[model samples]
Target: MGRKLLSLLLFASLATATPAAAAPTAAPQPPTELVTGLSLPWATSFLPDGQSALMTERNSFRVSRVTLDGTRTTVGTVPNSVTTNGEGGLMGIAVSPTWNGTSDQAVYLFHTSTDGGQTQNRVVRMDFDGTTLSNRTVIVSGIRSNTFHNGGQLKFGPDGFLYAGTGDAQDTSTSQNDSSLNGKILRFTTSGQPAPGNPFGTLVYSKGHRNPQGLAWDSAGRMWSAELGDTQFDELNLIVSGHNYGWPICQGSCSTPGMDNPKRTWTTAEASPSSLAIVDDTAYVAALRGQRLWRVELNGENAGATQAYFTNTFGRLRSIVQVPGASAIWISTSNTNGDKLLRSVIQ
Candidate 1:
């Protein structure tokens, strides 16, 4: 063969042998408004049916059922709930995975309440008969509450147990205290007992969290959390049973002997990440102060580069949940002035 022909053939062979770099994940399409005029909405939990979701309004203490078709109905108001006027009030809600609206109609809520003139955070269970909420039962209590750092996001893990993310309640000491429920991610059974094989013998699943607000499980069942740092950085942590995520010790990444560093970190100004949802291989985080939706590509246990969407467009994004049985996500705005719940198509 001629020299030019041989060189061209060698170049083509090398190109075919090299694997192509993966294409970057596309940003979510512009969101469509699903429900409007919400008041500081916080968390969203889709019912088993996937037709609607239960949402909480922070200051209103009202629980509402929001359908995908833009209809909103007040299911019931959580009695005895109080807001700290900052981050407290009716915060997180999770529907029982086994809920049938008949035999097992259990819905869980986390809220701040006043007890004997002291404010505290607690998780309660109620019966939802598909119309109204009733039978309020306090499952877990005595979590410290403050005006600022009251972490309240509840989710059912892939293991069928409930998990709670709590803040340090403005007291940094609680983050390292295993006996304290504040500043920790808690795992428990439906009936309010510590889950089997919990890292500690108590409800504490992991310790040393400053203000963890978001929890999600990747396709491999590994848990991930989004946390608000004090001033320097925000964190996306790979949560492990009993691992201490450096909090007062380290805000984002650290070299402490026994502490776990975050998989990714963003400046506090870039991400006050609240709720997290994993769709396919991407982890979507809703930012409160950042006023955007962050798409973090997940590569196994590690998080890749991030992309922000809807910055300053929808105001402060708070709650985000992957639409059940669909390739979409429902994210809510937290701006107190006529907030809205939006649905965005995940590419």
Candidate 2:
């Protein structure tokens, strides 16, 4: 069977027992803009104080800390090692999870740079001295790189290890190669060693992804990933340990043997998911080409209801980060083509 037909059949089998319900629609509420005038913001992470956030701009290789009062300051440059091309550059940033009551902690970054023959992806750590970055070190490197499909998103999982989302670098076969780090979610120690008790007992936690830009865990510690599809079928998946997500072989919902299926899939026109944040049972996905935010309700392992918000008000929503203890969310604008950073207060 064709890929799409097989996917539909699999989804039908999964949801066959339940009656079809109407797709959830977001309640109409005006979005209050918190800040503006940012250039191609890629990611956002809250400072330990909870009132400020650090954001990364893709093309500029600049990182800035913005306060709730609307002030912005440059934390530091991400080093001139990055080569800014189509979809590659300074992409993901995360503050050290051990940043409580200490000045020695740092923020981590994932970016693409040129080696000798081809571009490469590397992860670097930078010390934050309350005002600027101090010592910087490249902790991980040698991942596949290209002008496009350079998946660059990083997060610290509850397991106290750093998790990084990597793209296929436009090479489809790389997704299934165990030796290649491209097109996979890599789990490693804070010092960049492969984390203990990994599925492969190595850095690779899961494989067979196209371009996974979203990585977030629920309150139950279940890891979830949002992937950008090639031509159709953007997906939200419950990331299983050591399972293949079937990128080239299967796109969205999978019926093929030995492959995990997505919990939910949407037409690429409706959802070009980039970044995701989970609060309680709701998974908020940031859409880029779709130009909206998808709020998907999850009950255990099943998708419950889905809704879309901010339909063209903010242009391309590149990334969303929920405030640790607040009701507000920080959304980065993909003005890489033309947008701005926006802070959304859920009303």
User: How does each model score on TM-score?
Assistant: 0.94, 0.89
| lDDT to native, each model | 0.92, 0.84
Clashing pairs in 2: 335-338, 335-339
Candidate 1 — worst ten consecutive residues by lDDT sum? Answer: 17-26
Give me the displacement of residue 236 in model 1, in angstroms.
0.1
lDDT of 1 by residue, 1-347 (tens): 99999999999988886766555556799999999888989998989989988999999999999887869999998887999978999999999998889999899999999756777999999999999999889899999999989999999999999999999999999999999999999999998899999988999999999999999999899999999999999999999999999889998898999999999998999889999999986899999999999999999988997888999998889999999989999999988969999999987
Please tell me which predicted candidate would have the highest lDDT against the true structure. Answer: 1
Candidate 1 ranges with C-alpha deviation above 4 Å: 1-24
**Model 2, C-alpha of 232: deviation from truth (Å):** 1.3
> Model 2, range 1-347, lDDT digits (tens) per residue?
99999999999887974556645443324555566777788888787778788888888888888888658899888874576468889889888876752554679889886545456898888888778876778788888888788899999898888999999999999999988899999999878899988898778999999999999998889999999999989999999789999988999986899889999998998888999988766788998889888889889988778988888877788988887786667777786554566666654
Q: What does the lDDT come to for candidate 1? A: 0.92
